[model samples]
Target chain A: MVPLSWYLVVAFMLVGLGAYGMIVKKNLIRILIGAEIMGNGVNLALVAFAVYGGAFSFTAQGLIILVISVAAAHTALALVLMLMYNRRYGTVDLSIVQKEEVA
Target chain B: MNWKVKMMQDLQPVLDLFEQFEFFLIAALVLALAYLALEHKDIVYAVFFFGFMASAVAGFFLLLDAPYIAGMQIAVYTGGISALIIFGVLLLPRAQDSSLETFATGRVRTMGLILSGVIMAISGGLALIFPWPETIPEGVPEQSQSLQGLAEWLWQDHGVYIQIIALIILTTLVGAVALLKMEKAEAMSSITGEFGVEAKPSPEPEAETEVVDTEETSEEAAN
Candidate 1:
């Protein structure tokens, strides 16, 4: 039988990687990807517990994770779209924004 | 060895092989995809790689007996988020820019990597050393009909929280529309003012084309 600890270890490693990515990456989209990784790690832990702990059903955990994932997707979509719009205006660099000269 | 002994020995080798192969293979693929997503310079490619990583992790989830979460992982992350990210990448003017110089490095990256390594080491050690409780407590239900149970719980226990979250999402959508629409109006006014002429109400496609043309001209001038 596959032990639950293995899943926990994998989830921990993912979360660590995500934290590193968030800390190191400068790009907004990359940071969002990191955030997604972190979210995945949490989902993994949740499911692992549900499977092994016997306190909760797999379905309940699944539904919660599904809702959270959808919410995350919606938020990331909006943010990434906004970032692209900003990039189109010749500035993705967060430090400087050259205001359009309104004639 | 006797016949039974031989059979047991053969089965042991097969089980060991699968144990070694499946676990490490899935873990390596997930980690590699994650690294690629983090390191890729192109936002579009990064998003695509991230989607792969999510799908791989979802596979792992399924293997761990959480099939529902696995399905949602693919549906929400791969289907919805990845598509949105690609759309965002398409909207950017310099979508093809592959400059590694845009990435940050130096002390921060080094520290981040070191910290992550330490965390991983500690967590892995703990996972390996600690003994998990194997036996379930008496009276706890082992199997459940999930969907019906979840529906009952959602309505009875968490209905109000769900309603609040839904309301918040609705407000956010409204706010996003209002903000984007305002920006569009401002940009239109500015473009008209810059041309110093009564701007014809250009069709949406023509307006988009004009914006792209302006971006190309700007890029050319910069070069």
Candidate 2:
């Protein structure tokens, strides 16, 4: 079996890339994708730790499943919000704020 | 030698592949896909890449021997969430330029890159330095091999979490319906006010849409 540390390194890289995308992306949907990537990194790390240590492996998997469901729920709500924003403002760009500009 | 034995011999090297190399390849594929997804200017392409990333993460779970999680990842993230993202993309209006405007440029890009790099270095170094326990206690059981134990765990010990998640899903369903409903109830109230009728507030968009469906209510409100 390979050492556990390598998995951690991979997860770290994923988180870094996700953070970069989140910081740089202007589109709301792209930003959400970045957030999803970061969540995946966290899930990978949790599973890796559980697999290596053996203890809490079941719990870890359960929690990961929960995280997936919660993320789905969040994505649904976020997409609806994005749709609402698009309908209201006619664009999905994050640079525009209605309170400051319209009111 | 028999044909089966001959085939097995031929596939021996492939079957005996080390986990390390497998890990490396999967990690590389996942990272590459992630980069592509993030860098893609087209929202639809990025959404598809996101699905691929989720599928790759499911592969990682399989490598970890968590087959249940791998299946769930494929079903939920790759299948369901990707479809939702695509629908959102379809609903979005076409940009005049066809190119997404990104704020991640110049000074901001430099700062983001530096910050992410430092974070990755620190986390990687810490992981290497930390002494993780060598093995898990008495190996995870064979019975827990699939999702049997997970199902039991959810019902017996973690039932509350299941209920809570169900509640969250319900809330999200209602909230989404409200947010995406064809005409805001607030806008409807303004129309009602213009017609000089006392506006009945409908907090739920489902109700508002239903009311709009009935011409009588609208006519009464207008009158």
Q: Quick one: best lDDT, which candidate?
A: 2
lDDT of 1 by residue, B76-193 (tens): 8888777766766564434335562256558877999998889888987887777765454444446553556666766677676567666766776676665555465555543344
Candidate 2: tens digits of C-alpha lDDT, residues A1-103? 6678988988988998999888877688888889999989988998888777755457777788889999999999998888777656666787677345876
Whole-model lDDT for model 1 versus the true structure? 0.70
Best by DockQ: 2
Q: Model 2: residues >4 Å from true position, as ranges?
A: A98-103, B1-17, B95-97, B134-143, B182-223
> On a 0 to 1 TM-score scale, where does candidate 2 land against the true structure?
0.78
* DockQ, each predicted model: 0.37, 0.50
For all predictions in the order shown, the interface RMSD in Å is 3.6, 2.8
lDDT of 2 at B133: 52
Stretch of 10 with least lDDT, candidate 2 chain B? B190-199
Alpha carbon lDDT of each predicted model: 0.70, 0.80
